[model samples]
Target chain A: MAIFVNADTKVIVQGLTGGQGKYHGLRNQAYGTQVVGGVTPGKGGTDVEGIPVFNSVAEAVAATGATASFIAVPPKAASAAILEAAAAGIGFIVCITEGIPAQDEAKVYNTLVRDYPNTRLLGPNCPGIISPGKCNIGITAGEIAELPSASGPNVGIVSRSGTLTYQALYELKQRGIGVSTCVGIGGDPVPGTNFIDCLKEFQADPETHAIIMIGEIGGSAEEEAAEFIKANVTKPMSAYIAGVTAPEGKKMGHAGAITSGGKGTAQGKMDALRAAGVKVGLNPTEAGDLMAEIVATLK
Target chain B: MDLFEYQGKQYFARYDIPVSPGDVAYTVDEAVAAAEMAGYPVVVKAQVQVGGRGKAGGIKLADNADEVRLHAGNILGMDIKGHLVKRVWVEHASDISKEYYASYSLDRAAKKHLLMLSAEGGVEIETVAVENPDAIVLLHIDPVDGISLDVARDAAVRAKIDAEAVEGVADMLVKLYRCFTEGDCDLAEINPLILRPDGGVHALDAKVSLDNNAGFRHPEWEAFRATEELDEREQLARTHDLQYIGLDGTVGIIANGAGLAMSTLDVVNQVGGTAANFLDIGGGANADMMAAALGVINFDENVKSIFINIFGGITRGEEVAKGIVEAMGRVELRAPIVIRLDGTNAEQGREILANAGIPESKLTSKPTMLEAARAAVALANGN
Candidate 1:
């Protein structure tokens, strides 16, 4: 079975009254993600087209029994919305809003771990997760994903970068390789779910034959993930670390994507992955192709 | 947003964390007056963000106003590690009996607040980490329970802090932890948290990085924001709300998503061309943002050819194509552009470019990212 999400997962959209929330929320519904309800404080007892709207996450959870949440609230209120979802016992939460301050996420992360250990938060600035043909969450285009088939191998993917996740999927799709699940962990400095968390799930999934990981500069997450891969993951994996040519001390768009004081360099991450028996790709396409080779050998 | 020494002290003061009494001076005369106000035998330190200022001769002691003027005049306008010192912090000197280290930063792997306390201080913490890892006491604090006096005291004692100064250091540690959490600081570091001859713990240096995302809550942060130094390209990009980092190269690069932009830079470099800047349009690859990004890159004279790489996800391909075609009309280009357009509805995007009537001399589209990189590099070399 696919990890984190499947066809049976009931989902609620937080801030469904807003522009982004409504758009991606409805899009996810179209992809058959079982979008059960929406949450907007003042706009309760209403429905966005067909989806029921509620005053709070607790009401939405109680009424529809929605087990997952898609949060599209503004960055300032993102943490509060996430905490609300966790409090209401939404097992999985996906936040698509970017630009939430790092401190807000750090505090929210600690709160989630302490109070709601069962609640798994995906991202505050990520593309969210996609299990092709089965379910779609967040902003990842469902049309780009391919299901398990006779002609393609079902590989699992996890990445820190948004568009690079899409690139990896597209790269493999062109080569007739399908993905069992694609998870974008986001580029925020303090993400709720990291590489190790996602890797653990992918490793246990029987349908996921190979793994494709995309990481960028900044933080020791990738280096740590490399260490985890060496001991745990038996599946063939290919990885790509962006920002090989990026200079020191420059924040390259993402809050977490930067080389500060000679730490978190792309070369350092690449070296760590290579030493861990991971086939590290020099660039995005090379990384995708390397994964394709593993898939071909798998089936 | 790294706070200067004076600003860091002021930030620490808000949380009742003790820091040296200091004032920031922009001129030599202001520095002399600040020195006089701080009392005799003051220290004049450069207000640059980079470290190793003491080794760079940017820090010195001034026992009198004349010495203050001399030190300030020498340090001001002096370049240390590519950063020009426009201001100096004047503070009263302290007699230190012992030096220690204490800080709070996010441990991403642990998903908790990392408290690092060490008896060894007044130097780079990285060195202490490599040389004597056990000398540093690492504590992971949960934001829910928070840090109490007992927790701070326990960590202080375990860190091998001097027994006489343990209480004072622990008290300061509690306050420092508040500055890290409640203050919305990404990192609140006190290097050489000094134990004075009187057995008092004082912050000799404050290195703080305020979380930029928490700007909505901190209005006073504008004072620090105003003094941020920006170069030509950086300043221009700021006006457009585009993420751009200026680099020393010839091929000006623009792409959607941070990862793609960085990978674009790597691909350009791999093909034997250097990128002049790193520009990520994010989700807004629309007409207005594209023109704004193009204007910023064209402002750089070193740019020989522009590489516009777009891999659409939530960012639509046709919209980016129309933006590029429309942006090309608004701004006069100095360098030819090579576009590697793919992803969602990319076929429609390619169709729009082919029929746009924009001559090939100005815009050239490639089939793949690799081909586009090669084309951009080749065009940059005038081949």
Candidate 2:
């Protein structure tokens, strides 16, 4: 009962002919994801380890009825790939490519909002989502994420940091706890999906009894998400905001990590989350312990 | 990629936006030459990145070459907010009848291009957003529809811009919008979009921040690379393509992801020690990268010990172990290092480190992030 993905989801690789795309795509297939088809513009006729290949997302959609897309295209072509996936009516698109220009992301985000409301885009720089035994997308190591425990994959995780997401999953696995879904929303100027979006889904999924959210310094996303959780989410939540010890320096960008009036700092986010009745972990290890405490009390 | 005033004016010029004539001067002589070229009553402005230049006395109006030389000499070496000015932008001063504000940026929450226009200018826009919210027109432009002269004029009228200045301001707004979108800028701001005595709209100041990710498309941005201010350790990391941010502490920190590297700093500080730097080796950690990271940290004289915290996700544990072992032999040790390996073949990575025969005084492997942090902190304090 994962929120966005499960055992029955059909997935296609957007840049399957490239080195990283093919490598991780095959690994996802090895993890038992229904990697139905692969898409590469010129060499679509060729197959990669028995997976079907198509030139375009629309072709793959027509050929295999693939509903989801995993995009690993380079930064220059990443926005186009995401737009193409949305245009092809892919319900869920996960972009693992980093370094996408902020303007392109803004355009793509608004396009999805106005033209394609039903389509959901994950990240332009994130480590994708994983539902454990049911499905795995993006780059998270499957072994670190446990299958459904007796409670049925009860803990849900959404993080801005990729490594911290992996760290939290590994920490929870060591405690014999399994995750309902782990989402890496990516820390960027404009993420396709944000902490609030993931929280809404986790709050509704009955299998997800508790949630763990990890954020980093920069952006009002965490603070905004804390506001959303204060009213909407009933499940117990534990959170961590990275960069407490980060050096104070001048910020250049107008968004993401810096705001004029002091909204994106770690202390601001920690204070906001704590005021919302959520336990804020001092470190990644402590973040997992806080979540473990919630899972323990769930029964 | 926040450009200096002169560079920002250059960017505006490319979009056909009206900006003051300006040239950058590295020396007092250059300032005098620029002022002589631009004509009398020029402004000798410091090229430091921080704001409040005028209040800091970094900006001065000079009517002649002698005045230009005096102001340039004072502003060039002056430190404003810890930013030592090394250059000045000497430009012909404009006659302002009124001041207004206009800028283009992302409204992150609304997920749209936020165009902020205000009749109350020559002050911080954030201040206006709070004090007189009605005075500023906050327009959300859909990327598809973009900005046009009519729409800009409509917004100007709503913001209560003076009747005579609306046309000129509207025309400037359309060009500024093009600079933000076509010019690949994260922010393009004209603080005092002045209405001249002649009733012509002119940009008295330009504040532009180009998107770093868009550099691949804009080769012209290479000129700004010379203006990049990096400390010694950061300069070294840039050579190796490693993500490193220098900090003031004793424990040298290295990790695999930006999030983990940052959290590792907090972990170290929580255990009663400060981290010297934040270095993320990313997904592919080979010996060269490990050696390069170690070499860069070794250059920091304040580092008392190093913590190599690798939680292998896409970064294979065995390869990281091998990289660390091999990197140890490459760089001469200035500080002892503690290692914490987890995920994706962590056991093999740890075994490789232990079997490498490095003495406990030099290298020790811990089981978890907490233990590794404690060990590194202890080592840093000479325990």
Candidate 3:
């Protein structure tokens, strides 16, 4: 019982004719995702790697009855693609394109909240989500996440950065722990989802007994997540925040990973998570070990 | 992508928002000429991105050509809060009747656009937000619906703006919103949206920050990029298309992702070693990319040792190992290198590295991030 996606979830690819779309679409298909069809504006009659192509999302949805979508269009076309998917009534959408202007994301997000309340948008610049051994969406390498343990998936993982998401999952796998689902909400300043949003889902999933959250400096999202965890979450959580020694006012690669004017420091996030009764690890391996301990005690 | 005062004013003018007539000048002679054209009494304002220009005496009033020359001479080449003044904006001074504050920015928590308006202007908005929170009227605008005339008017009234100035303020707000959206700006701010003696409202100062992600839509932003000032190492990294930040330490750290790169820095510090720089080679760590990254790190004289931490997901460990070996042949290094390889065929990658026949004095490998950090730190400290 993973959140958002599972074995029966059928998916569609947007901009599937493009290089990135075709590459990851095949990968998602190989990972056992039911990638039914793809959408390309001009090449409607063609098929990409044995997947049927339609000119519009509506056509693809009607033809294949796909419930989820993966967007791999360029930055300029990303907002329109997301809106089209939402308008077509796709329940879940994950956008993997980076460098979409913040203004475009803001507009798309506002529309999603006000007009299409049912649709859940995952990322505009992220690696996307995966429910291990069931389904894979977006560009997370499918091989790293181990198959579910015989006890069923016990831990849920959420992160802002892509590689760290893979790192956390790999570490947990080494400890003989399997995941219910892992979501990379992205490192953009205005992401479609936040830490709290994923936390809420993890709490509701009966299969997820504990959670691991990977955060970094910049924005108050981590601090806000800590507040939500203290109030709502009953599941034990372990956390790690990167960039403790990162200098202020300099962007650390990721668009959203910057320490501003004494706020959004790593120390601040570490303190907030600790106050929420979550064990905070100084690094990735340490955090995975802490979560492994929590999973070990879950009878 | 922070715009200087002159550039911000230029952007405001594009939206037909009222701003004082101003021209940028790099020299005192140009300042005097601009003052003559604008018809003094003029204001000589230093062009620097940092705040507190006034408190630092970067702003001065010049009633004549001689005063303009004197002030401009003093202000140019002056250091204002560690930012050197490279230019000045000469403008015709306005007769201010009142001051108000207005700005539009993204509210990450709310996932919406935030509008801030205050009747108490000409001061730090942060101070106002902290001391008298209610004095500043906050409005969340839906991006699709935008701000209606009624909503804009309500914001002005709630800000305690004078009755006569409300209409003009609302009009300015609407124009500012257009500027913010059309201009693809993350922040469009007017510190002192001043009211003139003759019942005219104008933008006295402009502070804008454009989203670099939106560069594709606005090709004109190339002008802004051209004016950017970067240090030697930063310029080199920019040329190589590597995400690198220079620091004053001995260990040069490189990783595949931003989060891992930052974590590498933290782990190095935890092991009693400081990082010379932060470099993210990104997802594709092929031979060419590794060579470019290594070249950039070698240019930093402060670096005594280098750490390459790659946890392959989309990038395979064997490919990374080959890239490192190939890169070693491309560049001669001043600092010893420590490689930590993990994920996706890691054992095969380690075997490849072991059989490369590289000297242990110049190259060493560790299996874990912690051990790699300790080795790099010890080597950097000349242990």
Candidate 4:
């Protein structure tokens, strides 16, 4: 019912021996992700928190039939790990590392998009994508996710910023508006899937009645997506773009936040989205409330 | 990591791409000797980190040692695109029959390797593409197969180069790919890839950007790293091993989260203010870290106000508050500081800040980020 991940999805943990990978793998296992196995090369044949460790993703895939891979390797080695997972026929590769050199990711993305046309990549610096109520394949908190059986679905959430996703979800939860699937697409200069890409999937999901998209300054991706929304998106959506008054020329936060000399200004994106019939919020606080109001109004 | 022309040319030479004989000089005397070594009619090129040096007269052809001295003297201290010229590249001037352009860089936004080639070079290729879109050949190289010989040939043909010349251009493109990968360059460009009257492709100018992540593998780059000049705040951030990019705003931001910090900027901007810098103290923004963040922001004269937005998770809010309290003891603040504390031990953190009476009028405990941002913006504007 959800896109990209579900209960049948067996997962492999790349860099499972490392602190972050092991910690998250255990937590992910606790959340019922079916963390089938892991890959740590030298630390193979070992088990971290009861999850079997293997030398390579291929071994993990061959033995456990792990469909998805959660990559927690450092920035420099992230792309190589993604290529390894893709080559091994892992269905979804989620990269959690940040500061990946733009060139390296570009090379990795270009190759993956061309060679493994069917395989999907979630992030290089992104929070791993999740299909709530089915499986948690990424770095999103298990406690935050409300299952479909436990809580009825209302909206599909797609956000570039992970923390904002959590905050907005918390707000939605308080209002008793549970998510069908919440995707933290990761806020990197080059994300695996953009707002438009995620929108199509959310729109097609029958459980998802409305959509909420969180964005940041820099890049015309939002503007481009707004154009698509105007033409295609029938579902009502509420949006928030952070960094409204960021210094004119400074890249103060994320790599993608560099204003690109004002090409993708927050205000400019807000205006476009507004024009496209998306309800623009004052901030994250207003985003969920406004979205809930809009959804109710639509009902 | 953007390499100057001289440094880029060195890498081009490694691939056996033809480049005029050249040497880099840090002084006028050294430049004069390099011109002598290159043989006269030499080009005295200003070694700055920007393009358009030719129009700025940062580049000049010198026929003799006297001319080299004149050009190098004028260029050595000249400023080009905010970069002060401390060195000059003296090289043999070329005899150009035609000018073409080529570049390979990561189109990160698109998540692909972008290949741009143009028949019209010697001028800004961007201008050519903007004006005559058809004149420029844009190619997105498949990350897997890479820039194949056939694809390269196709690009060359699209650039309007003759079929015979496509073979050579294709070969050069392959070599350029090697330089891009092997050199760990984010960008490799040959502007004015000249077609000499003798019928050969010669790279008359080189623009390259070495990936900073790969800096560890290339020790030869250590010497070149010395030439870089960063501002005081950036230098401080480098010392702390923090990722900080300075801005020209008044509201200095210190937040536990990157997304929150960015939203803080948005909040500040929405309320009609500007955030001076983007400073993520990471998850470890304790007192010492707080002190470090304060120290870095305080150094910036542009930072008239400060905003601290923290959403404590595994990171304790009380510990963050203690850090800010301690930091206030060490550094005298010239600008107002706003602290929007939330999450675990948030009330306790607020209590600690309140007890210190660290500008109580300036210290408003905001319930939400939006309110805190509005207050900070108002305070920054002296409302």
Candidate 4 residue lDDT tens string, A60-147: 9999988899999887678889999999998788887877766676667777887887788887666666666678876666666555
Considering just chain B, what TM-score does every model have? 0.96, 0.96, 0.95, 0.87
What shift in Å separates residue B293 of candidate 3 from its native position after superposition?
2.3
Of the true interface contacts, the fraction found in model 3 is: 0.79
Candidate 3 local distance difference test against the native = 0.91
Give the Cα RMSD of candidate 2: 1.9
Which pairs of residues collide in candidate 4?
A110-B143, A111-B143, A111-B144, A243-B266, A244-B266, A245-B269, B287-B323
Q: Model 3 Cα displacement at B30 (Å)?
A: 1.2
lDDT of 2 at B345: 78
Off by over 4 Å in 2: A249-255, A258-260
After superposition, candidate 4 runs with Cα above 4 Å error: A6-10, A29-36, A58-65, A87-89, A114-118, A130-134, A142-153, A171-176, A246-253, B80-83, B108-110, B162-168, B256-259, B282-291, B312-336, B341-364
Per-residue CA lDDT of model 1 for B212-304, tens digit only, reads 778888899989888777787898898788999999999999999998899999999998999999999996367678878999999999999
Query: Per-residue CA lDDT of candidate 2, range A1-299, in tens?
Result: 99899999999999988887887899899999999999999877899999988999999999998989999999999989998999999999999887788889999998899889999999878889999898889888888897766655489999988888899998899898888899998877789999999999999988888899999887678889989999999889999998887655533111254434456778988999999989999998898898888877776
Encode model 3's per-residue lDDT on A1-299: one tens digit a residue.
89899999999999899978997899899999999999999999899978999999999999999999999998989999999999999999999887888888999998999899999999988889999989999878877786666575488999998778888888887788888899999899888888999999999998888899999999899999999999999999999999999999888988889898899999999999999999999999899999878877885
Residue-level lDDT tens digits of model 1 in A1-299: 78999989999999999988898899899988899999999999999998999999999999999999999998888989999999999999999888998777877888898899999999988999999887888888787777766444688999999888888887877787878899999999888899999899989988888899999999999999999999999988999999999998878999888788788999999999999899998887898889878987977
Interface DockQ of candidate 2: 0.61
DockQ order, best first, reads 1, 3, 2, 4
TM-score of chain A of each: 0.98, 0.96, 0.98, 0.96
Query: What lDDT score is found at residue B188 in candidate 3?
Result: 100
lDDT ranking of the models? 3, 1, 2, 4
Show the colliding residue pairs in model 1: none
Candidate achieving the largest DockQ = 1
Please report how far candidate 1 places residue B296 from its true position, in Å: 1.2
